[model samples]
Target chain A: MDQSRRFTQVPGKYFLIMKIKLELFGASRDLSNKDFLELNLKNKSSIKDLREKIINYVDQKFKGNENLRKIIETSAFCSEDNNIISENYQIDKDQKIGIIPPIGGG
Target chain B: MLHTKIVDLSKEKIKPENAEEFIASSKFGASIVFYGTVRENNENKKVTGITYDSHDDLVIKSFKEIYNEADQKLNIKEKSVYIEHVKGYVGLGEISIIIAVACPHRSEAYDLSRYIIEEIKKRSPIWKKEHYENKESEWLKGNPIQAN
Candidate 1:
């Protein structure tokens, strides 16, 4: 299999136009504490598509961590307005999105 | 009247000189203050220092709720209350929490202060990290009973 074709199978690279800022917390600090990457999504990218992009990207970066992938899958994305947008939500251009882990503090 | 304020006593500088003035602002005849300090011993273990952390928004909201409940339950009118909890690190003998209540009488002030502290400990979302002499850290979920 070609590397480019395999890359598409990963989940983190699906977005083409909207920029996102991913923050790390707790055990996620091991992967990339300051791993904020910007991706420009193609116009009218749905939330489901963007989540696929994220999964692909993270899969490529981490390679063998199934646990991290599960965490990413279960995690929710918060828009700039603090709204929890599901993986299938539509993405708007230049929107600031945050991927947050489960908050466990009392 | 009921008044309450919760502050980050660790990072934010608290002026001790103004403490008396602030706690005695109302024309109350008596004011009681309770200071909770970090000690060197916990559960028979030598402690170095303690680190406290909390969700800023949630802690503040919880403190407000507790304060309101105290006011309503005690029917404390013409009284003022102050509460502060340390965030970050607190050394031995450093005050981690402070509660002051002023009322027209000493008994009421004492009772109110105790009630507020107990409720804050039971209800607040603040967590404490205890650093022991062996360089070990343990997270305490709720306030543990202390020996006077």
Candidate 2:
């Protein structure tokens, strides 16, 4: 049940045009009301860049949902299983990252 | 060198007894079993049921990662440890998660079991939606929602 939807953003410095899918779950999904969103960004975008872009992206689309904005603010990024991401972590155009939303697991 | 006996995300009821049986052995004198269940009340509101969700593939991956780390970090790497969580609807008083650990000595087993559950909480990708008896549901985790 996966289909790609491209989100258009202004071209950044690294204009290599990479397509990365966002996999969301937990509180993130509950608040955002989305299962997934695709990011088509500069080729070698950092995790920090993606985070800001998500904020800007969501702000544009979900301006009314403050909770989801807060969730995006607190969410963590992972390229694969349990990869604790740092702000400096770079995402290749081919990489897919999962967003772990704000709520803690019990 | 604690070998992981089980790391699962099952949609069935979590049976603590099964975990007890898995850790039952003469070689291990100490064992610890912990169960997390759906209680009937939260903050004085009736919690009818809970629906647990997971990033299925990531949940197992995270569990294996935690299991492997526990096996090495605690020096009980070769001991027996099992962890499981339910993936679907679980009613009140029903078990949702279980952890069983055993070692030749009592202390290590207790310590390891404690470590596993805490890690699972901090690292696992599991999420639970609280369903109130009045039909209010929430996924925000911890904050109780008022039923209309």
Candidate 3:
């Protein structure tokens, strides 16, 4: 059988690709009009790696301001389903990430 | 119901003209009021004036949450609570937040009033910018503390 046909024929043996969608808000929103970011990975990427990728993207976008970086480091990131994942949590490929800035001002 | 408003809390007008109405409407024997004012000094800087800013929606939401938490913990009726905060620039000696709580007794009112202020300071996202005498301004983070 062909590779694609054999994969399709196998009920649960085929590898499933995982994709993550990221959304940014607040000062992070100001970083880019590309409001939605997507990352495709195998099912094994840890949430910590996802966070590192996000931090790198943010760092590249906003080169200035150590304060902003520190603030982002401390800010919380949530799944689109509103699950609070620890930085080290493993992320499924099809999961969604929401980046939330630390809210300031009354 | 608790009443909350965002305004430029002013000391000159701190005594609301309708104070009599608010006092009269309360059946509680004790009504405690707390006025938080802007001081002339912050940290070691001479503050000429202070500008208060907030994400109004979030701030109000947080304030309401704090108010609700107080009500739940204290079991106080909705009618016995009132909280107001200043959102814009408030100069020296201006009132920033006014909290009034009425309870059947003096102790509850006093305790609740203090608790509300403390919680608001710790949780509210409101920030203050201190304008120094030397024409410098600094953003103050977290809660305000009494000058040493």
**TM-score of predicted model 2?**
0.78
lDDT of 3 by residue, A4-96 (tens): 522222465765456678766444444567866775554666766776666676678677456556545655566655444576667654776
Q: Give every collision pair in model 3.
A: A18-A93, A19-A93, A105-B125, A105-B126, A106-B125, A106-B126
Ranking by DockQ: 2, 3, 1
True contacts kept of 2: 0.34
- Candidate 2 per-residue lDDT, tens place, B71-137, comes to 6798775577677777767888877777778888888878887887887777666777789978998
> Which candidate tops TM-score?
2
Q: DockQ each candidate and list the results.
A: 0.07, 0.28, 0.11
Model 1 lDDT, residue A50, Cα: 64
For candidate 2, list the clashing residue pairs, or say none. B1-B77, B1-B78, B2-B77, B2-B78, B2-B79
All models, RMSD in angstroms? 8.8, 6.2, 8.7
Name the lDDT value of residue A28 in candidate 3.
Answer: 49
* lDDT (10s digit) by residue, model 3, range B56-136: 454566678877787688766643667777765777887777777777887777778887887776656566667899998
Better of 2 and 3 by lDDT: 2
What TM-scores does chain A show, candidate by candidate in order?
0.68, 0.75, 0.64
